[model samples]
Target: MIHKLVTTPMNLVIKVGEKVKEEADKELYDLPTIQQKLIQLQMMYELGEISEDAFKEKEEELLIRYEVAKKKEFEQWEELTKKKD
Candidate 1:
């Protein structure tokens, strides 16, 4: 069975954000993408795979890469959606 969402106009952005977040969550653990690496860094930090200083360093690096990747993905999505408008 398929479920449906009942979103109003004002909730459109929220819905999209949730969808994007869901996609990001899925990709975070699947491979060695930026988000995946970020997930790894987070796990390492939590599980003591690296020192606090090392974890902080890798986390910062991964975060920067994640932001860049996320921006690119958003731009591509925006381009595609805008073309349909």
Candidate 2:
């Protein structure tokens, strides 16, 4: 009974941490969020709020992230399809 009391709280904490990490990943790697960021960055450049070099650097980062997000999304879809079959 004592062991269960100790381990049960630890297990709940671990599950909560995992859920938080999953949510954070989804927000970070979300396709629409990345695209919106890119659009905002371009607007900043066009409006003279950011320099060409800075804009290019940020754009490249966003592009790379977009590609990774796209690949992840595709893989997730594939997994879902496989599960259904």
Write down the TM-score of every candidate: 0.52, 0.90
User: Candidate 1 lDDT, tens digit per residue, 1-85?
Assistant: 1233544654888899999998976565333587667777788888988899998888887677667667777887999999999
For model 2 the local lDDT of residue 65 reads: 92
- Model 1 TM-score is 0.52
By TM-score, who's the top model here?
Answer: 2
**Which pairs of residues collide in model 2?**
none
Candidate lDDT (C-alpha), each: 0.75, 0.97
Tell me, by lDDT, which candidate is best: 2
